[model samples]
Target: MILTSVLPELILLSADFGLIGSPRWRPLAYQYGAFWAGLLHGWQPNFAVQPVTMFLTHAFLHTGPMHLIGNMLALGVLGQMILERHNTGQFILIYIAAALGGGTTYGLLSHSAVPMVGASGAIFGLAGAQLVWRWQDQPKGDLSHLRRLAELCGGMLGLVVINLLMWWLQDGQLAWQTHLGGTLMGVAAAGLLPAQRPILLKIRS
Candidate 1:
């Protein structure tokens, strides 16, 4: 399923790089698929559905090859982690929720007229859910386990540092608001979703 989610982006990248298909495909995809803050302000494009569909569609688009690769890697790793503890439906639900959350956040906070595209928001959501699972899996009522919680805090701080560095490097072009919203939704979803029970096997003697 993770691979399935990556196919559209790969195809789009190919078109954008002129490897196959018309180069125009990339621009068209962005025109219809990328989220535009202006849309929220009643700036309608030719496509009527774009205003609503862009919430999820923009996640499948990428600004460049590196952007796609990074998000896909995170999706594969963190997504698998999520799938291990929940059913496919739950995974999909969390992903969709995160994407919508990210889009909503971007719509509200960002003033850029440029279309936003990327799966980083959804990927960050998976990371957030993974963090919650780690916290839940820790041994309870044990003072020694405090170190694990601290490590989780450190990990979150590290994410903040990385976001800051990327924002600085990109000249504040990063959609950090989307990342923030997605992560919060992911954490909320993980808390609300049920975890699967561990399967046990019996050995015959």
Candidate 2:
């Protein structure tokens, strides 16, 4: 069950390995798979559904081993946590929504002609969904709940700081727009999608 739940992550890792082994494959994959904002603006040549497909495909590609490992690790942890509370289908939906949301935001906001790759946006989405679930599980209509809310806020602030540091380290190459979009979509998906079991009910029981 655990392996099956992480099938997507495994597939992504495998794809990354394949790309790494065949140096030539990386360029081809980036050309066809990575999300290019120019494709949306019609500045680049249309390639038969590439604009739409790139939204999800880009999440499967990574810039390097470290990038792939970082995203997969986060996905593995967050995916398992979500699976514990939701079904496989819900988890998949959230992931896809996040990828699409991230791509859309990047396309709309970023002016870079360079193709964007990596699953960080989807990882952030999972984090967002987890945050929502955690918040919802807290005791409401009470003073104690405020503490939990503060903690959540602190976590968000930490994420922002991390993003800023990464952006600076990467020389402003970090696609933060994607992260913002994915997070918003993940939070929305958590509320909109039905859980496999009510978290609070499970906790109380």
Candidate 3:
């Protein structure tokens, strides 16, 4: 995860990768508060004093196994399609762009005091690109797929509603704003990815 952030700097600035950090929770924190106290200090900090610091850093952190698993599942399903079509260079560029795109979009829209995190937005970017490519290349054969995709968006909207409701219950520690930003950006990006014609996909359906 940190590798994505550091690659740009490593290539340009020749900077050491030691200082960049991720602040995630662990299973043993309660059992060893003494050791983890410093972690808490780093994880949550004053945004007014460190807006640039958290804007990028926060995306790398996830709550626990459950949170990480849920996010990775979404990323895997969506990211696979993008990866298969694009080369390594294109993948890296698109992924980081989407990461920053989603993260920054969330940060800009947020009304909450707590900071934002996660890579769902980036995954959504891949989704957006896939939807665009499909539209540009495949002119026919599955209007059902289109409707199902629309339903999928609706289902995700429902999930967003649920996320917000639960977030309200938790007194607003959650950041659904990021999810919203990512989803929109993902949709918008569909129009942006250049159309590529593969031989097999071009054949009559």
Candidate 4:
């Protein structure tokens, strides 16, 4: 069941690996459709599919091996944790919403012609949802809530610092806009769910 949640990333990894070393496959990927700024701007070539579909499809594409590896790792770890607490349906909702949120942000802000690819945005969404869920689960009217909230924020802070460091190290190759968009959507979506009202809730004792 857990593996199904990350099936998209796994399928993407397989596709990326197959494309490697094949000069023909590179052109094929673009021909089929990959997300780019022009999709929303109405400048995308005739070969590309509808822009709306690309928003979700783009999440299944990656630039290279390392790119796929990092995202898959984050997805596996965070995804498993989230699944343990929330139902699969909620997890899927957050993932799709995060991807679209990221794509929309990138489409609106980026000027680059190159297609933005990877699952970083969705992964960050998982991280954000995880943080917010922990915060929301805290007991009410107690100092313990404050402490748990702080702990959640501290953990998120570490992720932010890591992202910033990676930005510097990669010479700004990361799409931080996507990360921001996904996070906002994830946190908001998670918070909107009714507290302790579902049978799927798996609160750890």
Candidate 5:
């Protein structure tokens, strides 16, 4: 899925000597982000240079297989949940917002000069949207429904907290800022999306 979605840009960006995530130049591409493709050889902090185009393309490029797998999994799960509660337009908007937020955060914070990549930021946003729904209401439907929702929420929350803590402890290369931005945007998107309370009959305490 990622190869089909991102391969085209990867090819185009590869030719441009300056593009950071140059798929044409596999070894080098590993280091830079799709956003950096335009900035590969150019001076940055200059929005006029090519920030707008990067805004859309950055989210498609990913760093590695692991990155793609994690992001795709989260996106698939939360995207379905969001779809259940909202329309396609809203989902698109949320995704865009997440991509932008993640990209901007990475651009502003990274000091290593490494180019960022992946749709992770957007996927994180979808996860956040699911969290928002859970927070708004506790177990309400079938005990099983409520239990699964609770389990999902708890697991996600735990993952985020643990990942953040690990980052703090090791000051590792993980995209902490990007994750935070995407997740927060995703949670906020839940509110923007339309909602319909699932029918719940109290069967037990």
Candidate 6:
């Protein structure tokens, strides 16, 4: 499933580098193959096909090597854990919901004309889902559970601080907005799922 999620990005990237021998290059090929596939797919923000489609399409696109590698790394690591605990379908659901939520938030809120792209939103969504899952299965009145939640909260806070610092240092190029939206959507989506006994819970019991 992780491979499935990554295949589109790889195919589009092949097109971007002119590896496919097509004339499309730079902005044309880049716009079509990377970051904002929505433009090439005939779905311009605020003008063409339903914006919702962009949510899914944009996620499959990426800006550059660093962008692609960073996102894929997160997807590989976090996605694997989530998929192990939940079914593939549920993992996919969280991903889709997070992408849509991130894109929606960016489309509605960002003032920049530069096309938004990347899997950070969905990756953050995975993190959000993991947090929720941990919290949900935490034992009642267990000090260990409380400690775990606290640690999780601390990690989240650290991430937020890092994002804020990056946003400032980079002169607001970072899409913290999408990250925020994706996280919220992930948590909400995970909350809707029926609770399951985590492996840790089993061991403790």
Which candidate leads the pack in TM-score? Answer: 1
* Clash pairs, model 6 backbone: none
Off by over 4 Å in 3: 1-50, 140-174, 197-205
Instruction: Rank by lDDT, highest first.
Output: 1, 2, 4, 6, 5, 3
Q: Candidate 5 — worst ten consecutive residues by lDDT sum?
A: 29-38
Off by over 4 Å in 6: 23-26, 29-47, 144-152, 165-171, 201-205
The whole-model C-alpha lDDT of candidate 5 against the native structure comes to: 0.65
Local distance difference test, candidate 1: 0.82
Question: Which candidate comes out best when scored by lDDT?
Answer: 1
| Cα distance off (Å), candidate 5, residue 76 | 1.5
| Residue lDDT tens for model 5, 6-70 | 57445645555565544456444442335653353455634464555665566776655555566
TM-score of 5: 0.65
In the predicted model 3, the residue pairs found to clash are none
Clashes of each: 0, 0, 0, 0, 7, 0
Worst 10 residues of 4 by lDDT: 196-205
Over 38-145, each residue of candidate 6 has an lDDT whose tens digit, in order, gives 444455645445344566666766666677787888788998778768887888889989988887777666665577777788888888888878666666566576
**Against the correct fold, how does model 1 do in TM-score?**
0.86
Q: Determine which window of 10 residues in candidate 2 has minimal summed lDDT.
A: 1-10
Clashing pairs in 4: none
lDDT of 3 by residue, 140-182 (tens): 5644676646755665666577667858985866555665665
Over the stretch 158-196, how does candidate 2's per-residue lDDT look in tens digits?
778978998999999899999988987888898897656
Give Cα-based local distance difference scores for all models.
0.82, 0.79, 0.52, 0.73, 0.65, 0.71
Give lDDT tens digits, candidate 4, residues 37-79: 7767767555545677767766776766677777888898998
Q: After superposition, how far is residue 175 of candidate 3 from its true place, in Å?
A: 2.3
Ranking by TM-score: 1, 2, 4, 6, 5, 3
Better of 2 and 3 by TM-score: 2
